[model samples]
Target: MGAAGDMSMRCVLLALLTAAAAQPEGPRLISANVGIIQVDCCFNDTVVDHGQVVFNLPSKCLQLVCNYGKIIPRFLGDPGRSHCCEFDGLLYAEGAELAGHCVVMQCTRKGWIPRGDIDDCCKHCSVYDDPHFVTFDGYRYDWHGYCNYSVAQTDRTYNPEAGVFSDFEPCFGGPSCLGRSTFKDHKHTVISLGHSVFNLLVNGDPYAVPLVGAEPVRCSSKVHPVLAWRNGQCTMLLGSSKLMVQHCRHRLDVWAHPTHADNLDGLCGHFNFYDADDFTSRQGDVHPLEYLPSTFPHSWRTLDQTDYRCRQCKSCPPPRVERLCRADERQLAKYTSICEKHLGSVIDRTEGLEGYLETCVFDICMMYQDRRNDREVQDWLGILQKNVNMAHMIINLRLGE
Candidate 1:
């Protein structure tokens, strides 16, 4: 071979090596030699040991269907809604370009495949593709928003038979300015309660009780007060407001009932007012389930004389008010009566109640006191209690025999 030819070949080889070294590490070459890409970007690439593939998406554009299904992406033109479709262990990627768009897929023997062009992964509601907002139960909202106020709402109906609500109506605003819908809020409220109850039951009360110890645990039940909204103010649900001294015996109870700390000094009250801040401004705030009375106090009166007096004294409205209905009174009366008539010895017959109450009251009280200054903490406790109550209702429904 000639020296000129050899020199040229060496120069060409050097140039190729330099070009390869200059390329950025982020993008995949997508050539025969590169079948997978792993970069420090948002996408999480995964190839299961069992030959299945998994990838992380921004939650807005793509979602994983079933655990083992193949994934495919589709793209349409202009404001297109793109998605990753999963089929029999295979994937298809398609891109969309139109606003208010979605990518749809059809299942076939060949694997899950994109349905020609123009179909969407979402029906009724537009696909949520924002970086910060996400869809839960078909409502899109930024979880970071104040008290979940960022959640978007749409007009929809509930179908008890299917155990799920129907698709939401098209939101009037362009996704960002939508208000939370009534149905979505209600459903989410129920779900949130269930989750809180499950956590407390698993990690708070039931597990806190000691199995073997010298201080054998004893649990007792009592009735806690119920508060509701009436006449645009916070008041007792079914109890009367007028005081009955000698002739009228039933107490004309008020908000912040058991007004005296002495009333809450017993075992049942200990759990009821089990706050570390029992001596502070936050006293009587936390009422945990483990410490909740088995029997609930009920009345047919609606006026809140005590709360009214306080409101009148301050000449101000209640700080926070919740919507209430008469039906809840029956529920309150029924649940409170569950263990009411039983003798004090019944605590000995109750299995695991003592331990649960002790641990739950201790943990929750300490937690409450620690965060007593933070109003948000109290808000969280109230929300969690609602969930626990719902969970109890569910269990009672299933095993109320």
Candidate 2:
């Protein structure tokens, strides 16, 4: 129509049409200035300062940032097993102190989170001076008892919800602190089968010594005895490992038939195994089998196994043989069953891959440190985990009987 507004619009539309025709997707034109734009509540740090408000900014800054808002999440890494982080249930690394020692934190969590100690700035893992403690009534437990006990640095108080007994008290004394309540009328028999010796228990006594041609001998009431099973052979204390290993190799697996002891040379051998309570005598002065000096290449002591005197006693007639068939098979199967059950339980209770790795990976690796690389470490870890559990179960089952 040749009107002033119509002429101006025609000129603008003709210029935009020419520019839009050059591109694959045509762009449309809009007014340079528009109505007020909405503000974003959550925004990226790069777009605006975390605390910056769009309304407070100058018009130029607001215009520049008008369409650049984004609600960025706290963490941006892929959520996968490799990205999963974990902390030890009992200890966490805190920043170093001025003294140059790393501080630790005590805390626990059930699942993945962006940060630790969400309720507070500080994060920690519970630490204890003594890892093992007794209950009010006298049951003992270590860090592994997390299933049934709460973490308390020095407090031994029981928690009912956690299944800890209220009356179990902590015991701080030495081995003698174990009273008859733990084991009453204990009897232990050590039958030497020519080169190897087998141990069995009745009540709480474990002093039955086997002979070659005579009846099995029981130690005198005051006589204390320490029995060791090493290299698959059993021996009384004060026997040399070299001689025991030499004689017991051929007869390692054979069960000792009840017979009188003709000579001591036939009885001693390098022991490969032992019960948890094997080292202690009736007098309760000796250490546990795991703590014995032999484990560390130290010299053996007669007094360590005796509370009063260290006199060697004569061997006696063999007692009646009991449970003569498939003893080793029975023992091995028992260990295997206990190990499988406990390992399955561990896997089920663990939350994630990282959680499982944190719980037992170190112990498993350290157990077979002679090996190398990830594959070897993993294989050994699996083998050792099962073996360690089996060994522990054997100890308890044997001693508890």
Best by lDDT: 2
Candidate 1 off by > 4 Å: 1-24, 27-60, 63-392, 396-401
Backbone clashes per model, in order? 41, 46
lDDT of 1 by residue, 104-221 (tens): 2232332222233322222111111111111111222111111111111121111111011111122111111111111111221211111111111211122122221101111121
Residue-wise C-alpha lDDT for candidate 2, range 1-401, written one tens digit per residue: 24764565445444534432332321222434874333333222223332333221111111112222322212112211111212211112122111111111121122111122112111112111112222111122222111011221111122111110001112221111111111011123222223113342322345433432111123433222222222223222211110111012111111111110110110011111222322322223334333112221111121112222222421222222222122254544543454344364654544321222222433332323333455654554454454333333322322111
Top TM-score model = 2
Error of 1 at 308 (Å): 42
lDDT of 1 at 33: 67
- What TM-score would each prediction reach against the true structure? 0.15, 0.17
